[model samples]
Each structure stands twice: as structure tokens, then as C-alpha cells.
Target chain A: MITLNIIGSGNVAQHLISVFQQTENVVLQQIFARKREAVSHLVADAEIVTNFNDLKPANVTIISVTDGAIAEVSNALPYENQLVVHTSGSMGFETLSNKNRKGVFYPLQTFSKAKAVNFKEIPICLETEKEEDFALLERLAQSISDKVFKIGAAQRQSLHVAAVFSCNFVNHLYQLGHEICEEHNVPFDILFPLIDETADKIKTLSPKEAQTGPAIRHDQKTIEKHLAFLDDENKKAIYRLLTQSIQKNNG
Target chain B: MITLNIIGSGNVAQHLISVFQQTENVVLQQIFARKREAVSHLVADAEIVTNFNDLKPANVTIISVTDGAIAEVSNALPYENQLVVHTSGSMGFETLSNKNRKGVFYPLQTFSKAKAVNFKEIPICLETEKEEDFALLERLAQSISDKVFKIGAAQRQSLHVAAVFSCNFVNHLYQLGHEICEEHNVPFDILFPLIDETADKIKTLSPKEAQTGPAIRHDQKTIEKHLAFLDDENKKAIYRLLTQSIQKNNG
Candidate 1:
């Protein structure tokens, strides 16, 4: 059985703790939080500890803390030459101190305290400093997820940036759309199917091929009408810029 | 049975024809194309007519052509005072000549020639100049879709603009993300789950409440890191602008 200890009481940490507890052939050794009470609800009180020095030795220790806290927390780990990893998409593997056999077990997904995500579908991006530690990381990742990629720091950083565009920026566009609907007193639910279909199209077709609208068709009249209709300067600027970008890319 | 004639053989017309043919109590009387062969395969040869003058009278004639062509085609319909509608989100009801009763039957979803969409889930936005025509239009719309909305010209136009933001512009962001992944030699499939989850979240949470990531958290370090990582000037500009927009919106 693969023994595991998780640090932090944030969304990622709590999610991992819940999944690992239910996973077969995996023993959740302990959970270490800055305050033991923070993670006490996630695990038995016996398995929750406040001090890093109280962390039990396990086959793998996942530091699922915030990006800024990852380095400081990793450096503070009392144990040495153990399989230690952090669940961060943007931070480099080197962020984990060399005092431990450094690795990464980043799950490429957004976690919410309210939403229950299926861990089996989430893609786990794995990296390891030592080749021997790679097998355990891969096995642990595969146990919880169907997809696992051996990604380095550079690729992970790029993936995270790309994610910012696809997830964060695209969501901002949804917010803009919602605002437009609200201004016009139209229900925002009307846009949900369209949003779902747009995302679904990218699965089968490249975003370039899936692109459609006045911009791609260069329907100047409609474009002008839409621009005249939008009152917000920020939205107008975004509309013009993205229209130009689409035309330029597809042109 | 409600008799219907469909004009134009583009993506929207083809999709409408497919759905209308399968709808109960709806008879697809004829399909008019500039070139009959363009839509002959969609329906029997007898139902496909190349000449606008040869179009038969029906309860309703749907001009499913491009935005610019809607007026021309609606004006050219041989029958007068018949219930004539165009399936365009952006076009106004007046686009149809006064010779016929005007209405709009816009399906508020993207239509692709290659992809077969489930028409039942698509929202059909309906508008009519004559209030009595509302029942027929709503009946036709409800026959093919579960969701139907009675929207006016201004509201429809606004909804179309909102759709451009939510669907078209969002797809462009996905394209940018795909490009970034290609540059990093990472398969774009890794971001699919995250993208789906982001879209799914807004269904329950408002886009503002659903927002997450560096920009929303005011993580300046990660934002700067991502901006520096992006090599394309256009992408970098979009990244910066959208980051600013998110902060401003959520702030």
C-alpha cells in the first residue's frame, strides 16, 4: 500500500485528502496543517497535527498549500530525502526544497469548497527530481486519475498560463456576456446552452475551425451595429480587439 | 399540421430542416435554395426548389439566410401577407418586407455543418410583428426545443451581442490556449476537464461568484510571470487587459 501524508487545509488539500481516503491500496498516514483544527474535519483528530515536526514518514508527502507558502512550507519539513511534492500548477518543481527528494503532483483542475469534483477525470501533471521517486508519483496519480503526464516545470508553467486564458479569461468573457444580458433585462440562462456548446465544439474541432460569428465572416455591418450597441468602454475595447484578433488569426 | 417552407441551404437552414422534419405536427413543405442541388440531398428533389418564384404558400416561410441577405430574400418571397420569419439573431423583424407578416425564429446556439447538435436543448428565441402570430411561432419553436423565449428586436440584438462575447470571443480564448499548448508541446486535452468545469460552475454560481485564478486573487507575481511567459504581443495584450478587467469587475 502507498502511504500518504497531505499538508494544508485549503481546497486542493481537502479534496486530495477526501479522495485518498477512499482510494484502494492507499493509506492516508496523516494530515499536517498550520492549525490542526483547520483540517480536523477532513480527517480523524488523531491524523491531524499542527507542527511540521509531528508529520509522520510516509511513502509520499503532498504539500497542497498556496503557491507563496509552498517554498516556505517545503523548506520547513523536518524530514529529509523523502518523497515530497507540491500540488501547484504554476510553481516550478524546484520550489520544493532540495532537503527532500523533490517532486510535483499537480492536478490540472479548479477546486471549489462547494463543488464535488470527480478525481478520476482530472489530469494529474507529475514531475520528479529522482527517477526512483517517479514510479510512486505516477502510481499515486494514476490511482486517483485516468490521465497523467510527465511534465517538467517549464511545460507546467506554460500549461498554467494557457489555463488562465482558457478558464480565467474565458470566464471573464462569460461575465461580460452576463452583464450585457442583465443590462438588456434578458435572462442569463439563455446563454448557458450556447456557452456549453462552444466548449463542447473544441473537443471535436480545433478552436480555429470551431470559430463562427460576425468577426470571422467579416460582417462589417453587424460588427458596427454591435459596437454601437455596447455602452461600456471596456467591453467595447475588448470586442474590437478580439474581433481584430479573430480576423487576423483566421484571415 | 403546421406547414413550413425553409429558404436558404446554409448551416442554419440545414440544421433547421433536419430538426423541423423530425418535429411532430410540423410539415416541411418546401426548401428553397439559390441552387436546388445545394439542399437537394437534405430533402427529396420535389421539396427542393431553386426559383424563389416557384416557392409554395405555407403557414410559415422561414428565411434562414445570412444577415445581409435576409431583407433581399424576405422581399422576394412570392406570397404576400403570409407569416414570414427569418432565423437570424441580429436581424430585426422589419427586415422582412411589409407585404408579409413579420416574425423572428432565431435559435440562440451556434450551428455547424459538420456537427449534429441536439435541437431539443437549444433555446429558440421568437418575435413577431402580429401578436396572433405568437401562438404559431411558439408552437413551432416548442415542437423542436424545450426552451423558448419571446424576445423583441432590441433584446434579440443585445442577446446576439452577448452571445458573441460568450460564444465567439470565448472560443477565441480557447484558440489562444490551444496555441500556447502547441508551443509548449503539451496536448491541449489536459485543459478539457478544467474548461468543462469552469463552464459548469457558472450554471450554479454567477460568473462573478464563480471567478477564480491569479487575477481575481490579485496575485501580482503570478500575473507578471504569465505576462512575461507569453511570447505573442497580441496574446500578452489580451492577457493584461483581461486581467485588469477581471480585477476591476470583481473589485
Candidate 2:
């Protein structure tokens, strides 16, 4: 069985706390938050620690704070030479204080306070400074998730950027779609199935092979009609740029 | 029973034929293809008509040809004053020849030859010249899908553009994401769960509310790191533009 201590009470920390509490082979030893009230609803008061010195040794200590605060919190840890990790996609494990055995336990999924996620489906990306510590990290990751990958720091950075494109930029497009529908008095829910299918198609086919639209078809007439229909300059610019990109990629 | 004749053997037409064949209250009368070999595998020789003049009378003749050919195919129908509709998202019902009663039967989802989609989840946007014809169109749509909307011509145009943003543009972002992973030797499948969750989150939360990442957080450090990491000028430009757009929208 693996015992873990999670720092911070943000979205990622809260989510990991909830999942690890229910995981069969894992024991959440303590939750360290700046404010005890920040995590009072998630765990018993006895399990909450507001001081770094109060933290007990666990198999792993996860710093789930914001990226900017990761280094500071890792530096503030009172103990040394024990397993310490951070749940960050953009930052590498080297950012963690070298006083402790450095590692990364980043889960490659978005966590929102408004919705609870199933940990089993989330892919855990792991990295370790000492090769011997890799086994414990993998076991910890696999206890709650079926997918565990030993990704290096460089590849993780690229994956993070790729995620920003797929998740952040894609959601922005949905917002544009919603705005268009709202302006025309059409329901935005009408596009939900299309959005769902677009995501589902990539599971079986490559995005290049699954691409379908006027942009890929090079139907200039339809493209022109669509361009003239949009009044927003931002939306129009995006439409033109993305259309050219798609055509160029296909060409 | 609502009898329908489908013209063309494209992705849309073939998918419609497959679903309508299994529909209890609908009868697919005839399928017209320029090349008899195009639709020979889908229907029997007796049901395939190469000549439009040989098209017999049906309750509705669906001209599912290319957007440029809809008018010509509808004009070529031997019989006049029969209910005729074009399956187009961009074009209105007026695109069909005035010789026949006009209507639009547009499915607001991406149809691909590589993947088969569930018709029940697809939202069918219907529009007709005569108010009475709407009932028949709705019945035909309801026979397959549960989601139906009587969108006007202008509204349907906007919906089409919205679809382009939500489905087509969104899929392009996925392609870009896949390219980033491939360049870094990271298996692209690692992002599948994240993609699925991103799509699923918006079902309950608005896209604006569900947005997460460095762009939304206004993390200049991470953004700069990402921009510096990308070697491609196209991707770098996209990252800057989208990041700016997200910030502007949130601001």
C-alpha cells in the first residue's frame, strides 16, 4: 500500500485528495494547505496541516500548488532526501528542490472545481531523478489510474503545449461557435453532438485522415459565403487563418 | 409511411441510406448515382437508378449531391410539384429548382467515410418554403433523430458557420496537437482522455466557464516558455493569436 501527502487545496489537489481517499491500495496520510479551512470539507480536521514542519513522511509528497509557487513550496519543505513531486505539466521536475528526491507526478487531464473526474481514466505522466525511485512513482500512479507513462521532461513540455492547443484553444473555438449561435437566436446545444463526434472520430482515425470541412475541400464558394456571413473581425480573422492553415497542411 | 428517394452516393447519402433502411416507418424507394457502380454495394440493382428522368414519384426526393449540383439535379427531375429538399448546411431551401416544392434537410454533424455515426444523436435542421411541408419534414427527421430544429435560412447559415468553428476548426487544433506530440516522440494517445474530458466538461458548463490553461490564467511565464519551445512559425503565430483572443474575451 502507498501512503501519500498532498499539498495545496486547489483544483488539482482537491481532486487528487478525493480520488486517493477512495483508492483501494492508497492511503492519504495528510493534506497540507495554507489555510486549514481551504480543505476542511474534504478531510477531517486532524488530517489537515497548515505548517510544512507538521508534515509527516509519506511514500510521496505532491506539491499541487500553482506553477509559480511550486518552487517556493518545494524549497520550504522541512524534510530532505525523501520522495517529493509536483503536479505540473509545463514545468520540469528540476524545478523541485534538489534537497529531496525529485520526481513529477503530473496527471495529463484538466481538473475543474465544478466537476468531478474519474482518476482511472486520467493518464499519469511520471518522471524521476533517481532511476530506483521510478518503481514507487509508477506504482503510486497505477494505483489510481490504468494509464501510466514514464515521460521525460522535454517530451512532457511538448505534451503540455500540445494540450494547451487541444484543450484550451479548442474550448475557445466552442465559445466562438456558441457566440455565433446565440447571436442568431439558435440554441448552442445543437452543436453538442457535432462536438462530441469530432472528439470521438480521433480515437479511431488520425486527425489528418479524419478532417472534413470546406477548408479541407477547398470549396472557395462556401468559404466566401461563410466569411461574408460573419460580422465579428476576430472571428473572421480566425476563420481565414485556420482555413489557410488547413489548406496548407493538406496541400 | 414516408417514402424517400436519395440522389447521389456521397458520404451523407450513403449514411442516410443505411439508417433509413433500418427505420421502421420510412421506406427508401430509389437511389440515383451517376455511376451505377458507385452505389451498387449499398442497394440492389433494381433500386439503383442512373438516370434522373427514371426517378419515380416519392413523398420526398432528397437531392444529396454536391452543393453546386443541387440546383441542376433538382431541375432535372422528370416530375414537377413533388416535394424536393437539398441536404446542405450552407445553402437554403431556395437553392433547389422552383419547379418542385422546396425544403432543407440539414444534419448538423460531420459525416466521414472512415467512421459511422449514430443518427439518433445528430440534430437535423429543417426549413421549408411552405409551412405545411414542415410537418412532413419533421416527421422524416424525427423518424431517425430525436433532436430537430426548425431553423430559418439566415439562422441556418449562422449555424453552419458555427459548425465550421466548433467541429472543423476544433479538429484542426487536434491535428496540430498530434503533430506536436509526434515531433517530440510522445505517443499521441496519451492526450485522448484529456480530449474526451474537455469535450465532456462543456456539456455541463459553458465553454467560457469551462476554459482552463495558461491563457485563461494569464500566466505570462508559461506562455512565453511555450512560444519559445515551438519551432514552427505557424504554430507560434497561432499560439500568440489564440492566447490574445482568450485574454481579450475574458477581459
Candidate 3:
């Protein structure tokens, strides 16, 4: 059985704790939080520790903390030459202190406190500095997820940027759409099926091939009509910019 | 039974034909395509017609042609004062010739010929010039879809613009993400779970509340790093613009 100790009390940390607890082949050694009470409800009181010095030695230590705090927290780990990793998509694997065998166990999914996520489908991007540590990291990642990608720090960084475009920026576009619907006094639910279908189309067809609309067709009349309808300057600018990008990319 | 006739042989027309054939309360009277061969495979040869004069009388004659062709098609339909509707999101209800009772039956989902879509969940936006025609249109819409909205021409036009932002623009962002993953030699599947989660989150939370990532946090460091990682000038510009937009929207 792979023994794991998770550090931090954020959404990612809590999710990891819950998944690891239920995983048959894994033993959750302990959970570390700045305040033990933060994670006390997730595990036994004995398994919660406030001080880094009190962290138990385990087969793997996952530091699922904030991106900025990853370095500081990894550096503060009392033990050295142990398998230590952080769950960050943007941060480089080297950000973890050299005292421990550095690795990355980034689960590429958004975690919300209210949502119960099934870890089995989440893709865990794993990286390790040492070749020997690769097996352990892969094994640990496979224990929870069906997909485990052996990506380097550089690739992971690029993947994070791609994610920002696909997830964060796309969600922003949805926000803009939501605002437009609200202005017209139309229920936002009308857009949900379209949103879902747009996402689903890419699974079988490449996004470029799946693309459709006035922009790709270069229907200038409709484009002008849409632009005239938008009252918000920022949204108008965004619509124009993206419409141009789509035309250029597809044309 | 509600009798229906479909015009055009495009993705929307074909999908509507398939769904109407399966609907218990609906009787698909005929399908009109300039080239009968294009849609003959979908319905009985007797139900396919090349000339508008051959179109049979029906409760509704849906002109599911291109937005540009709606006026001409409806004007060409030999029948007058019949319920003739166009399946376009952006086109105003008046686009249909005044010779016929104008209405709109826009299905608000992306339809691809290669993909078999389940119409039950797709939202059908219905609009009509005559208030009395609403019940008939609603009955036709309800025969195929579970969600039907009575949207006015103005609201439907705005909703179309909103759909451009959410569906067309959002799909372009996915294209960008796919390019990024390709450059990094990372399998795009890694982002699938994240994409699904991001889409799922907005179902329960407002897009404003569901937003995450460096821009939401105002983490300038990671944002700059991501911008630098994007080598393409257009992509760089998009990254910068969207980052600013997110910051402004959330700030």
C-alpha cells in the first residue's frame, strides 16, 4: 500500500484527503494545515498536525497549497530526501525544495467546496526530477486517476497557460454572455445546451473543424448587426477581437 | 397530429427531420430541398420535393434554410397566410415574407451533420408575429424538445449575439488551448476534465463567482509568465486582453 500525507487545507487538499481516504491501495498518513482545526473534520484528530515538524514520514508527501505558498511550504518540510510534490499546474517542479526528491502531482481540474468530484476521471500530470521517483509518483497518481501523464516542467507550464485560456478565459466569455442575456431579460438557462454542445463537439472534432458562426463565414452584415446591438464597450471590443481571430484562424 | 414541412437540406433541417419522424404527435408532411438527392436518404422519396410549388399544406412550414435565404424561401413558398417560420437565431421575425404568418423556431444548439444530437435537451426558442400562433409553435417545439422559450425578436437577436460569445468565441478559445497543448507535445485529453468541470460549475454558480486562475487572484507574476510562454503575437494579445478583462470584471 502506498502511504500518503497531504499538506494544506484548501479545496485541492480537502479533495485529495477525501479521495485518498477511500482509495483501497492507499493509506493517508496525516494531513497538515496551518491550524489543525482547518482539516480536523476530514480526518482523525491524531492525523491532523499544525506544525511542519510534526508531519509523519510517508511514502509520498503532497503539498496541495496555494501557488505562491508552495515553495515556502515545501522548504519548511522538516524531513529531507523524501518524495515530496505539489499540486500546481503553473509552478515548475523545481519550485519544490531540493532537500526532498521533488515531483509534481497536478490534478488538472477545478475544485469547488460544494461539488463532489470523482477523482477516477481526473487527469493527474506527474513529474519527477529523479528517474527512480517516477515509478512511485506514477503509482500514486494511478491509484486515484485513470489518466496519468508524464509531463515535464516546461510542458506542464504550457498546459497551465492552455488551461487558463480554455477554462478561466472561456468562463469569462460565459460571464459576458450571461450579462448579455440578462440585459435582454432572457433566462441564462437557454444558453446552457449551446454551451454544453460547443464543449462536446470538440471531443470528436478538432475545435477548428467544430467552429461555426458569422465570424468564420465572414458574414459582415450579421457581424455589424451584432456589434451595433452591444452597448458595452469592453464586450464590443472583445467580440470584435475574437471574431477577427476566428476569421483569421479559420480562413 | 401536428403536420410539419421542412425546407432546406442543411444540418438543422436534417436534424429536425430525424427528430420529427420519431415524435409521436408530429406528422412530417414533406421536405423541400433544391437538390432532392441531398435529403432523400433521410425520408421516404415521396416526402422529398425539389420545387416549392409541390410543397403540401401543413400546420407549419419551417424554412430551415440559411439566414440569407430565409426571406427568399418564405417568399417563394406558394402558400400564403400559413404558419411559415425560419430556424435562425439572429434573423428577425420579419425576415419571413409578410405573405405568410411569420414565426421563429430556432433551436439554440450547435448541430453538426456528423454528430447525432439528442434534441430532447436542446432549448428551442419560439417567436411569432401573431399571439394566437404561439400555442401551435409551442406545441411543435414541445413535440421535440423539453425546454421552449417564448422570446421576442429583439431578445432572440440579443440571445444570438450572446450565443456568439459563449459558443463561437468559446470554441475558438478551445482551439487556442489545443494549439498550446500540441506545441508542448502534451495530449489534449489532460484538459478534458478541467473543461467539463468549468462548464459544470456555472450550472450552479454564477460565472462571476465560479471564475478562478491568476487573473482572478490578480497574480501578475503568473500572468506575465503565461503571456511570455505564448510565442504567437495574436495569442499574446489575446492573453493580455483577456487577463485585463478578467481583472477588471472581478476587481
Candidate 4:
């Protein structure tokens, strides 16, 4: 079994601990967090270390810290020549510079602390400075998920940008919709089937081919009518800009 | 079997025919289209009637024409006394004026002629003038779909607005991502898991609770960097507006 030491105690840390613990070929040896008390529950079976001196040696030291702290943490951490990794899609693998062997084990899925992550289903993106290290990281990822992509740091960054649009931005739009529904005193649940159907359509069709809207069709009349329904300038601006983009791009 | 006459051979009419045919107690008796050539393969069993005067008596007549022509078709149609139902969600049930038994069988889901609808799963938005007719329509709707909602035109307009944001607007945002990915030589399918995950998140958590990205965190550095990645000012404007909304709404 490969020994694992996870750093950071946010959603990614807790989720990584649970997944690693379940995998037959993996063992969670330690968990490091700035506040040891906050992450005690996460590292209950494993050793909990708050200081970089007691970072401990492991086959894999997975860092799941925030973007800004990645470089600082990597520079301070005392895992020399160990296989150091981070679960960040945007941050480069080279952030863990002290390690002779470095890589990424980024799961291309969002995590909420309370939500259970299906590690087997989530696609883990693997990247490393050395070929052997990359292969080792790939194997660890494949043990958990069938869909493991060997993506470069640049590609991962781009994919992360796309992810922001597809996941985060889309959720923001859902929030806007929920807001509109709340304002109108209409049940937000009414939109669930349609929302689900839209996602389902994209599986079989390209987003462009599956696209359905007054904006896509250039039905300015209906677009104007829908725009009239929005009281918020931000919502109106979104409607106008999206409508313009659909027209300009598709035309 | 309750015999039904479908007026108009447009998207809604064909979908309604397929749905009604699969239903236990409903049988399509006729298909009426303005042009003689409009009726095609699937409704071959149903007699095609071009002239409204040639329309035969049926338990129900579903006018699935465009919104602008709803009143025109309803007024010109010879079928009377039978439940006259129009399928436009935005149009009022009272538009089928001068007819004693008028109602609406507006399907909340967007329908395309090429797309086969699972009517059993789609929520049929039902409204009627008479109390007994509402029950009759509700029973008929329940026979084909478990999700039949009793919604007035105004409330449905609100739901339709919500649907625009959730389905149409969301799809447009996806199309933008696709365009950007294609331009950058990145496989757009890489964003599929993220898209599916975003939709799945809202199923379990509220959109506000599930919100992510630089905008929610007000990470202006990432937002500005993303904007710099795009060359188009219109897109930049959209990104700015949406980010502003995300920040404002979060507060």
C-alpha cells in the first residue's frame, strides 16, 4: 500500500482522505492543517501535524490548499525528494519545488464538505515533472477513477477556465433564475425538469446544436418581451449581452 | 378511448399527437394543417383535414399553433362544445373566446419537431375556464404524465421566464465556452463533466449555497485575468456584468 499525507483541511482535504482510506492500495498516514483542531476529525485515524517540521514522509504528499498559498506552502514544507502533489486544476505542479518528484492529482469536480464525492466517477487529471512520477500519479488516479487524463499544466489551466464557465458560471445563472423565481413568488422546483433536460440534451448534442433560445433564433420580439420581465439592470445586461453574442456568433 | 383532434401540424401538434397516442384513454382522430403537405409520417393514421369546416367532432381539440395565430385558429375552427385547448404557455386560456369550454394544455418543456418528447416526464401546465373542464384536463394530463401542474397564465409566464434563464440562457453560456475552447484548440468535451456536475449540484443544494468561481469569492485577479484572455469587448462586458451580479448577489 502507498502511504499518503494530505495537506489542507477544506473540502478537497476531507474528500481526498475519505477516498484514499477506501482504496485498497492506499493509506492515509497524516493530515496537516494550519489549525490542527479544525482538521482532527478529518485525520482521526491518521497523524495530525500543524507544523512543516513534522510534515512526515509519505509516498504521496497531496496538498489541497488555496491557490495563493500553494507556492508558500510548497516552499515551506519539509518533504524533500518525496512525491509531492496538489489537487488544483489552475495551479501548476512545479509549485511543490522542494520535491524532486512532483505531480498533480486534481479531481476535475467540485466538492462541498457535506457532499459525498464519487471518486470512482470523477475524472482525475494527472501531471508531473518526471515521466516516472507522472506514471505513478496516473496509476494512483486510475485506481480510483477509470477516466484519468494526462494533461499538461497549461491544458489544465485552460480546462479550469472552461470549468469555471461550465460549472461555476452556469451555477451563477441558476442562482439568477432562483432569484427571479423567488421574486415572482413561483416555485423554483418548476424549473428543475427543464434544467435537467437541457443538460441531458447536451450529452447527445453539442451545446451549439442543442441550443434553444429566442437569442439563438434571433427572435428579437420574444427577447424584448423576456428582457422586459427583468427588473434588475444586471439581469437585463446579461440578457442583452448573451442575446447579442448568440446573434453575432451564430450569424 | 377519448378521441382527440389536433389542429396545426407544427412542433407542438406533432409532439402532442405522439404523447396522446401513447396515452391509455386518448386516441388522435385527425390532424389539421393549413397547408395540405404539412402533415407527415407519424400522424399518417390520423385523417388529415385542411379545411376547418371539414373538422369532425371529437372529445377534445388541441390547437398547437403559434401565439399570434392562436386566436385566429380558435375563432375559425368549426369544432365547438368540445373542449378547445391551446398549447401556448404565454397565451391566456380566455383567448379561445366565444367558446364555452376553453382551456390550455401548455407543456412547460420546450419542444422541437425533430425532438421526441417524453410527455410522461414533462410537466403539463394546465388551465381552464370551467371547474369541471379543469378536472377533465387534469385527469387526461395525469394519464400521460405524473407531473401535471395547475398554473395560471401569469404564473406560467413567470415560470417561462425562469426557464429562459435555466435552459435558454444557460445553453447560450455553454455555447460561449464551446466557441472559446474551439478558438484555443481545447476539446470542448473536457467541460462536459463540469457541466453535468453543475446541474447535479443544484439538485442537492441551493444555487447560492453551491456558488463558486472568482466572482463569488470576488477574486478580481482571476476575473481580470480571464477577461484579458478574451479579445472581444462584448464578451468582456458580459463577463464583467455577470461577475458584478455574482458579487452583488452574494453580498
iRMSD of all candidate structures: 0.8, 0.7, 0.9, 1.6
Chain A TM-scores in order: 0.94, 0.95, 0.94, 0.95
The true-versus-predicted C-alpha distance at residue B53 of model 4, in Å, is 3.3
lDDT agreement with native, every candidate? 0.90, 0.91, 0.89, 0.79
Better of 2 and 4 by lDDT: 2
Q: Report the candidate with higher DockQ, 1 versus 2.
A: 2
lDDT of 4 by residue, A1-251 (tens): 78888889887788887777777787888888889877776554788888888877888888888777777887777758888888877778766776447888888887877667677778788888888787768777887887898888777777777777777778888998898889888888878878877877776677777776566666666677778878888888887887787788778
Q: Model 4, which residues run further than 4 Å from truth?
A: A98-100, B35-39
The recovered share of true contacts, given per candidate in order, is 0.82, 0.85, 0.81, 0.60
Q: Which ranges in model 3 have alpha carbons more than 4 Å from their true place?
A: none
- Total clashing residue pairs per candidate? 0, 0, 0, 0
Least accurate 10 contiguous residues by lDDT in model 3 chain A: A37-46
- Please give the DockQ score of every candidate, comma-separated: 0.84, 0.87, 0.80, 0.64
User: What is candidate 3's TM-score for chain B alone?
Assistant: 0.95
- How accurate locally is residue A22 in candidate 3, as Cα lDDT from 0 to 100? 83
On DockQ, the leading prediction is 2
Which regions of candidate 1 deviate over 4 angstroms? A35-37
Q: Is the docking of candidate 3 incorrect, acceptable, medium or high quality?
A: high
Residues A70-164 of candidate 2 have per-residue lDDT tens digits of 99999988888889999999898889998899999989998888898988899999999999999999999998999999998999999999999
